[model samples]
Target chain A: MMDTEHLGTHISKQFNADLENLREEVLAMGGIVEEQITLALDAFTNNDSDIADKVIANEKMVNAKEMKIDEACTKVLAKRQPAAGDLRLIVTILKTITDLERMGDEAEKVARMAKAIANKEMAVANVKLHYGALLHLGNHVKKMLHDALDAFARMDVESAVNVAKLDNQADEEYNAISRQLITYMMEEPRRISEVLDFMWSARALERIGDHANNICEYVVYLVQGEDVRHKSWDEMQRLAKDE
Target chain B: MMDTEHLGTHISKQFNADLENLREEVLAMGGIVEEQITLALDAFTNNDSDIADKVIANEKMVNAKEMKIDEACTKVLAKRQPAAGDLRLIVTILKTITDLERMGDEAEKVARMAKAIANKEMAVANVKLHYGALLHLGNHVKKMLHDALDAFARMDVESAVNVAKLDNQADEEYNAISRQLITYMMEEPRRISEVLDFMWSARALERIGDHANNICEYVVYLVQGEDVRHKSWDEMQRLAKDE
Candidate 1:
């Protein structure tokens, strides 16, 4: 197994604190991103423009937090000049926050889709917009993101790989929703615009799942010093579990 | 202006060469990604599965190149212990590859869409899946990506900002195409699937523009040491030229 304790055993206590602080900041940012996804989904399912607006408003804070974490990472790299695991930790944080920021952007897109759909009522009175699958998919990805963040906080490579493996499930769920939406459009062509908007929101949720998987991969890399991206899931699971 | 010469004046000749080699790798990777977009678009416009297969095959190489550049950056950081401009260079390259790799994925999506559309021909007789706007948008983003890489190569903040401004134009083009496609779908409901596929290709092209803009933003950060993300184009231009 990797020497996980070495991450916190630097001769410079301040450097250790810097790394710890960076981790905390990332978890905090992840919390905001997770909340954004939840709210964006609630807005879509419940047709609540107020919740969507809140998500949009919170996006700026998310962006600011990303910039803050990035600057902190640069400061740590320049000042401490850490090597080995510490260096990997910083690199992983840099990459993780980029994914987090993109997750926030995806959440914003979901919110925008919600707003657009709310502003324009569905053309057909009886043809209700089906969102059961989207809600299920949203919850699945949200749980995956939460678990991925937990793995990051604990530096657990096995759990990280497991979360990464959830991506296939998310893709399947997304494909099912796409097929269902395509059927709806065919049945009632007048609702095509709104149905397309729903597809975009579902697409956004699927992308959030992707970003969460990326974070899990980065976690595995940070802990094990192995790059698991673009690898088959079987290979990733084997590598993560080998040691 | 920031001291551009500092990037090349490192005392260790090997360190300088390593940084130079890293830049070359990134540009080479960018070239491959650019070609992927061009080929993917050709595949879509011409309904040629052969070119689509070529783009799909090229994606593996793109992924491999990203991993190689990432490893090189990590090595440079661990060994050279670069700071300031050199550190930013490595960070910028890391971020650039991520965007470039994503651009490659978007290209692959376009190729997949082309294959899907070609396999199951459009349901309508005379609907004619339009390509005029999509071709224009594809070329616009391609040039934007090219200019963004040129800005990175020269570390020119001004050029980066100018290229970043083109994102608005790309967005406008995408919006126009989306509207036109919606009209076609409404006119011929049977062709909705094919029109939607066309919409996806256009969306993919628009995303490529966004990634190119992201790369330009990273160039500004690398050269000027300013995090200009989430800022207005006016602010980015002012910041890029202020010195």
Candidate 2:
């Protein structure tokens, strides 16, 4: 009986180690997802189909990584019967994979938009009003995604909350950009459809920011064991402030 | 030993029953979500705040139901260790909840837009092209969501594929509506912001259709255990055609 007990403990330790490795794998996948988004955006802004094609080619990697991570999660879930924190971690991996996969889809959309505009003459004249703002918003999104992943790695709720705050700034910038784009479209009716397509690309980037915010929410849940969703932005700010 | 064996069987049976109940609950939630979308469109078309208010109130119910379903899923997952088909069902519930919650958010957005336009004078020229196409698109969205949920509950993959096919029609209508709204904004620059706001409401409705398509995709997965996501519309159609 004592030998059996010792073997059981050893198996549990092995399982725990596998779970930690799975977590690292998921973070690696997240990093690739964020890079894909940034690359897809750059391809769009520069009108480079080669870069866009690269983004499309990389989606197979994303899909493959997602499946591998999912398999790891299910294996851990089935064999370990992880309770409490470990269970939550596995569940978060599963949820994050879905978000990451959708982000990949958004990136593909950006690439497709870029491909459509590849041969067209540059319409830089109308995009000037909000170029700085859009770039700022894009950088903010990159930071949010970066910091959120870092926070998840370190289990730092404070960093996660900070990432969530940046999402608001991104939102404001998106609104300003959209308003300016509408004005641009009105001024140049001939370019209406093309500009609208670009607006859709911007919207996709803004949505990626929202998904980053969602990842931060999951991080907060992981740390606090509480559901912070459905709360107002002001309330979330206050809570983060208290933290 | 006999007693322990009996207890195990009893637990398994109870767990299966709970899983079925959870699936039913999700379907019921889907029904309520679809209704909110339909009613919000009605409120927008007829300038009816009562229906808008009802949708807003129903959103609370949807939220509460989501929590209940989530709780049930957690309990089963923790205690039951469900495998194979049962495991797939639980994952489906989790994914479906996210879609349903998003649908609720879209409904709330539509209601808010309706309320904003409720007190205002209707458009001066009655925008014949905008409202006509939007009304038809809205009805199509309602039908698509209804059919998707039906396919989900019945595990009818063919029906789900059919519902998915309708998404293209909705997208076409959405594009037509957006062009009309843009034309209006161009004609009346002063009303640009308001027109843009109304356009977003229509956009949200279009997104609801997209989510319905996503649910149908999930149904296909449930039935065939295949991941058809990220495939081209033509490819998906081909697969369905072969069936």
Candidate 3:
């Protein structure tokens, strides 16, 4: 029989626990995205097409997990009719899952670019193409994603703000690598396809960094009810610290 | 004064109207994005950086509408404690506003690229770069976005599926333009930056098309409660029509 009265204002322990389970599911899916980014980056730097294939293969896992979490959150919303903070948590989960799914899509794009470049001469021309910088940028983006998920798990606004600050580094790294690669493309056209592929991979990482930053902003919104997208990094840090 | 009894499950008319208000707000935001895409495309084809500047300026309008709609949705979710279809509508709005905002960002990126290429001699060389193909692809994406929003407003599942199928044309257009531009870059290195700029604009439109497709998928979930992302386009078409 339906426990129709469970939707009342009195908090139910089972519902609260169910909410926690949803957050845990989000964290679990996030861990997989972290793995996808790491493997995809490894494939790029090592020219390991095998790992690239794995990244491609693992994308299905991310999509499946997203569907699962989304269904769980929707069920909770429809059944619980949760208010205030509980409502915020479920809504945030509903929104962030899409962001996380897009991050998976970006990682898959990077992996595909990696596979395309694996046998190319530019794979060996790492120095000529600033491949190390791209790797560094990719690694940094992966770390920010990890920390952002951790922040969400803990509802740690400070860590989330710090993640946004890290995006500046990602942006700088992307610009530096794009300029270097663009110059290379113009100066010497022999490895143009290979160089462009490397640039595309780096660009994908840069976008992933932006997505991670977006996730962090959502964390702030969930915790503080403030939209921080317009705030400067320093302002975001101060907001997190103040509360 | 607050409606104290709104906490109950009687389905208040005011609350229902408020939910309708939220959907109207989303539709309003959708209208702005449609304008942004149209202007951005005009900017690209005409090499009219001034129109591109207008699109950039309009980005703020889209952002403002998104923030307002988001805050309004969160308010309704927290206060009304809406269940079932009302709840789904709010959740979908929460998720889709982000997608619309990202579409606005992509339009802004295209506009910026247009401005960068406007005064260049290569702007006139768009004919050589398959700019018409990009324009056609972008127009298709805009139409899909328009139809997707219309489908969402009406909760029309069949139209949403049709919007997803249109993504195929966008993908083909993107590939055709990319392949043609890559050949041009290889054959003549003089206008490499211009050609690359064109490619980036086309790529941004393609991503916008994907975002539009994402919006349509959310509409299906809102209406049918079915997660259709995993389904093949053919399957999605069959499912939408079957229901």
Candidate 4:
């Protein structure tokens, strides 16, 4: 039984309001997760072990938040047995928390890489890349995450679609950077270890971007009651147009 | 309104039976996905374009099966509105199908890699070593999937735990293969493209193994009704002991 004293609302209204709180909770968790990614990438690019430590420490916070949200969802289901649209939305939330948590996991991987390379600076400084593409991709991904959350908040299908479209550019950047890193490794085998860490970070960021896109797709499905997840990008684009 | 005459069972009994049907459907889907992985890995290791084409073709079947299972889960939720243990089991089924579908996607990635490198084998053959560890890992992962699915069927926590334990060795094999491939790339710059494809397939296999471990953990959670997913392996081992 939910307490009705917050607004002195009816039980039915309170259940409705609790669902709203769940959304707010998810968004708050998303905010912390977004910051974790920034802190991680900053730590990674600068080789700052202190920032990396912060990211690692904050991981527990993200995990705890996910558990709290999941419990809230299960409580709602067991108590209310929400039907149809509400059920779909709650299930979508359930799915997205894992993605958000996974994004944190990916960021933690980058942070761990940062921590590992913190004391090994000279090795990394020796490897030359083309035009700072990894940095560019990392920066673009953080913004993509920001917008994906915003789109989710408003259930903005168009905005989510646009963010998903940026994935192609991110893919191109990942490929270009990977090729340059390979060339670097080929030329200076001594720098292989250092370059490999950077490659993993790039791959992690790219996956984070993919997960962000996945969250937005879930939002579209939540709003439209259509499972757009199983389709291709072209099909998603068509679906977005109808929205 | 579920059809009660399917088995001529009472409504309550029919709901119970439908849950069984959901499990069987998931297992049936899991079987095909397992076959897809075996076929894809066989294609990758042999560089058989014909077999790779078969794996790629089989992907649609996997996707369709996931959709069908998803629909079934939704039907159960709407009709039965199962609570407690039954609800948790249905939810677990929902989560694992996404994982299984993603496993199929990873296999498709390996298949595509096989297709890309099928005609261009000279570079790959030029740079190889280390007792076929990658092949061994792929084969073991298929076995891990077999046991994990078996654990799900019987609610056998011990079997699930064993499969999860095997992930550490799989991780080691994947890393060793990756390092060897990197060494190959350094030795022969012309082989970078081919080696990169092999590396992607190895990473995909590693990820597939990870998803397998995740499914096992879900089995543990299903039986114990505890969320042990966010814990470390040591933490999980400790938690399991407490259980």
Q: Which parts of model 4 have CA positions greater than 4 angstroms off?
A: A1-9, A126-131, B1-9, B126-131, B238-243
Q: In model 3, which runs have C-alpha deviations exceeding 4 angstroms?
A: A1-11, A119-129, B1-11, B119-129
Q: Fnat of each prediction?
A: 0.49, 0.15, 0.57, 0.23
Q: Where does candidate 1 stray beyond 4 Å?
A: A1-11, A123-129, B1-11, B123-129
Return whichever of 3 and 4 wins on lDDT.
3
True-vs-predicted CA distance for residue B190, candidate 4, Å: 3.4
Model 2 chain A, poorest ten-residue lDDT window? A1-10
TM accuracy, model 2 = 0.90
Clashing pairs in 1: none
TM-score of each: 0.93, 0.90, 0.92, 0.93
lDDT of 1 at B76: 86
Best by lDDT: 1
What digit string (tens of lDDT, one per residue) describes model 2 on residues A175-229? 8888788777767766666776777777877887887777777777777777666
**How do all the candidates rank in terms of DockQ, highest first?**
1, 3, 4, 2
Instruction: Tell me how much of the true interface, by contacts, candidate 2 captures.
Output: 0.15
lDDT of 4 by residue, B76-163 (tens): 8777667788888988898888788888999899889878878675645554453277678888888888888998999987787888
- Candidate 3 structure quality by residue, lDDT tens digits, B1-243: 344435555557678789889889889999999899999988877889899999998998998888888888878877776677887788789878888999999999999988888867553454444766887888999998999899989999989998988999899888888877777777666667777888899999998999889889989988888888877899888887789
| Cα lDDT, model 2, residue A236 | 62
How much is the lDDT of residue A243 in candidate 1?
63
What is the DockQ score, from 0 to 1, of model 3? Answer: 0.58
lDDT of 1 by residue, A101-179 (tens): 9999999999999888877865533224467788899999999999999999999988888887788999999998888
lDDT of 4 by residue, A58-163 (tens): 9999989988898788788777776787787788888888888988998999899888878675646555343267668888888888888898889899888888
Candidate 3 on A27-90: residue-level lDDT in tens? 9999899899999988987888999999999999999999999888878887777778887788
